[model samples]
Target: MLQRCKTLIVAIIALIFSQQALADTAWDSYKSRFLMPDGRIVDTGNKSVSHTEGQGFAMMMAVANDDRASFEKMWNWTRKTLQNPENGLFYWRYNPVEAQPITDKNNATDGDTFIAWALLKAGNKWQNPDYLKESDAIAKALVAHNVVRFAGLQVMLPGAKGFNLNSYVNLNPSYFIFPAWQDFADRSHLTVWRDLINDGQKLLGKMHFGNPQLPSDWVSLYSDGRTVPAKQWPARFSYDAIRVPLYVYWFNHNSPELQAYKTWWGRYPRDKTPAWVNVTTGDTASYMMDGGLLAVRDLVLQPANVAAPQITAQEDYYSASLKMLVALAAR
Candidate 1:
């Protein structure tokens, strides 16, 4: 009887593992179709390239999946092709065909930083120093050259020389480079993490895009503490906004602020999935990949015993997120 019980337990464990393995492959395949040779995943059916957020989010998935080869190829392509000398930043728009930067004028500072962060993570995982060093260089460049002064907030400008500062100061910019700032906090022993959080919070507060739905993006800041609302160009609340909530929870835990943010999200039914929502209204908008990624993070990292629902929305596209969730859950 004892031997039979042990065999049953082992079989159950094997069954569960097999199911998870198959599920992971399905998700990986769904995302892999969008991936480009140079690591840029183009819009479906259209050859036009997208920005770093999706690319970064996908890379996060790669990290989650422990796909070292995929991670390496993407990171290498991003660094070699995207590095910009003029602003010491990473160019935002790239040509899909040749995988070359489209506009020297539009550098995506956040994407650059995020890629550097992913590379650093990969380096650390594999015990390689070169990737770490490369990450460090990009971090320095983002801080040194791409920052713009606006409305009393120090903001990341859109591109290097001659780019429009007035257009870049919105909330979306904060999300782009913040991951790198958070990642660097432990290594450099600097308050870059706190600084970014505080600065972003300050900007978030100022936007008065209140209600915790967070703006998709924002405009550049000026010398004085005033903002020019990019209402039309708002970054659109989606997965990016979830970072603010996640950040608050990570640092503040179950504090009122974190609860408030979570409650704000709770107002929406999980069944009514949309890509974007107005920060104030919570109305449904088209869905995007970031929304799915953010959902995974929120579900896995919710304060212990918190009553938030576990998101199982897009199982395949979000497989990387699922792996991450499992890892965190195990921890």
Candidate 2:
């Protein structure tokens, strides 16, 4: 019995090491494909532009892979290039081809949250105080600029501005980012993070629409606690809302919020699952999801089936990034 127990322990250790090795190889491949020499991570599918979302994702990836040098390189470039002088928060997008790349000064709340969350993880993992300080600053600025009271709920706007109206506020349900909110609450002991997490989850449970009864990419919350898909955008659960499940699953594997997605995705064949479904009209994406969405689906339904992050031929930036994210959360 003792010998058999020893053999089982050794096998478990070997499996862990093997999984990490696979992850490291995937990280290297991601760096080669998208990370620029100067630390900018290009969105290869979108005019080769860079954005805070990609940078944050890469920073988290670096920390997960234990690539300290890459993390610092990316952080330095991001600070120098994207940080707004008037505010500590980061600007959203950067287009290299534009003569004036940083024309838009709007701060994306999701990007800010991701950066702060990744920095916190890096700080704790690597015992770096500077990262922690900067992370707190970003989180503070994020709360100052975007977090707001709406419809009797503490919700985060999709950006620093342009979403708040007199009677209603626009929200991206995908930006709930539950796991990161939990980290912030744990690290800072801020009741605001806790409030956001609780209210955000409840809001999500109420935002389902159309025949599919899935949350849309964007929703409008009125003063009376009414929620509906925002009219300005397509009323479909597409690129952005897809991550809702990924983040929720990260926070709670047994969360009831995942049932709608599970039911919807389960109705379609694996390859034939449409990328988005209009919650109002029951419309669906013309084409199926890329490898990333599939990875997210498996992560929600069967984590054991999620493959390691690999660059599928012709996969775009968002697809590749989400695939990496799923792998990170699975481990």
lDDT for each candidate structure: 0.55, 0.91
- The per-prediction tally of clashing pairs is 23, 1
Lowest summed lDDT across 10 adjacent residues in model 1 is found at 305-314
lDDT of 1 by residue, 1-331 (tens): 9999999999999987875675466446535555666676554423556666445556655765677777776666665666566555666656666645465446665577667677677778878899788777777776666655555555555444554445344435345344456677666666655566567656755554545434445543545665543555654555445454444443444434444445545665554445556665545566533434444445534444332223343433333333343333232
Candidate 2 clashing pairs, residues 3+ apart or interchain = 210-279
> TM-score per candidate, in order?
0.70, 0.96
Q: What is residue 185's positional error in candidate 2, in angstroms?
A: 0.7
- In model 1, which regions exceed 4 Å deviation? 1-23, 45-50, 97-101, 148-168, 173-179, 207-216, 219-228, 232-243, 246-257, 273-275, 279-331
Displacement of the residue 107 alpha carbon in candidate 2, Å = 0.6
Model 2 ranges with Cα > 4 A deviation: 1-14
